[model samples]
Target: MRGYWNWLFKGDRPGLYKFFDRWFVFHVLVGASLAMLLPLSLQATASSILLPLASVTVGLSFAWSGSAQVLLQSAEIEQLSSFRVGGIEEYVYTFQTAVLCVLITLVSWCVAGLGVFDLVWPKSSIPCVYGMVCFLLFFMSSVTVRECWHVVVGAQQLLLLRYKVRMDAEKKTNS
Candidate 1:
C-alpha cells in the first residue's frame, strides 16, 4: 500500500519534492478549477462515466503490460530493457496503473453511495463540505485520466518500437 503510494507519487525519485511533479500540480489545478467553476454531481459522474472509464483503462493497461513483456523479450530492444520509470519496469508500471484506476473508481463509488444517507450538516458548513467532496471527486477523476493517458502512451510506444524493429529487420534482409 505504502509502496504503491510511493511509486505513484515519487516514482524512482527520492524526496517529498517528487510528489509535486508537474502533472500532479496540473491535475490539482484543473480539479480545483472545475470544482469551483462547474461542480459536478459525484453520484451522477461516478454512476455514468467513472466505472466505464476505469474498466476501459484496466483492459488497456493489461494489453499494454503484455506488449511491454513482448518488447522486453525482443532482441532488438535488449538494450532498452533497462528502461525504468521511477525505478519500476514498464510492465510493472502498467499493472500498477490499472490497479490504481480500479481503486480510484471504487473510492468514487463509495463516495457516491454516501449520498444515500440523509446525514445533516450545519447549514453554514454544507456548502463547504459539498465543495470539498466535489473537489475530491474531480481530483480522483483527473488522476484516472492521467493513468489512462499513461497507458495510451505506453501502447503507442510499443507500436512504434515494433515498427522500428520490423523496418530494421527488413533493411538487414534486403542488404
Candidate 2:
C-alpha cells in the first residue's frame, strides 16, 4: 500500500491537488456506498453540504486569482495561446464569479444555520446530520473540481504541444 501510494505521487506532489483527485474518485464510489447505507430521500441531504462548499471554493479561487494581483502575476501569461481570452477577460470573469459565489454562500449559510433542514424533517436531528454531510460533501467536491481542472488545462496544453511539433516538422522538411 505504501509503495502504491508513493508510486502514485512520485513527485513532491501538490497536496491539495492530490487530495482533490482522490476525493473525486471517492465521491463517485461513495454514491454507491450511500445507496447501501441510506434511503434514497436521505441522499438529498448530501446537497445540503455540497452547494456551500462548492461556493466557498469558487469564491476563494476567484478572490485569489482576481483580487490578489501578486499571486496572479506569478502565473500570468504574457500572451494567451489557446483562446482569444486574455488576462483582462480572466480578471473580469474571476471577480464576477467570486462575487456570485459570496452571495450564494451567504444565503445558503443563513438558511442552513436557521434550521431550514429541520423545517423539512422536524426534530429528528436532520439538521445536524445534514450539516455534517454537507461539510464532507463540500470538502470532497472542492478538491474534485480542482483535480479535474488539471485535466481540462492539460488538454489545452496538448493542443499547443501538437501545434509546436507540427511547426517543427514543417521547418525540417523545408530545410
Which is the leading candidate under lDDT?
1
Q: Write the per-residue lDDT of candidate 2 for residues 48-106, one digit (tens) a residue.
A: 55466556555455444443343223222223322433333333333333344344544
CA displacement after TM-score superposition, residue 68 of candidate 1 (Å) = 3.5
Check candidate 1 and list the clashing pairs. 11-86, 12-86
Q: Give me candidate 2's TM-score against the actual structure.
A: 0.33
Show where candidate 1 strays beyond 4 Å: 1-20, 38-41, 73-75, 83-91, 114-126, 162-175
Q: How well does model 2 score by local distance difference test?
A: 0.45
Model 2: how far residue 101 lies from native, Å:
23
CA-lDDT, candidates in order: 0.61, 0.45
**What's each prediction's TM-score?**
0.63, 0.33
- lDDT string for model 1 (20-88, tens) is 567898878877887688634555555676557657767766667677666656665554445534322
Taking all chains together, the TM-score of candidate 1 against the true structure is 0.63
Q: Looking at candidate 1, what is the lDDT of residue 174? A: 100
Residue 137 Cα positional deviation in candidate 1, in Å, after optimal superposition: 1.6
List pairs with backbone clashes in candidate 2. Answer: 20-143, 49-134
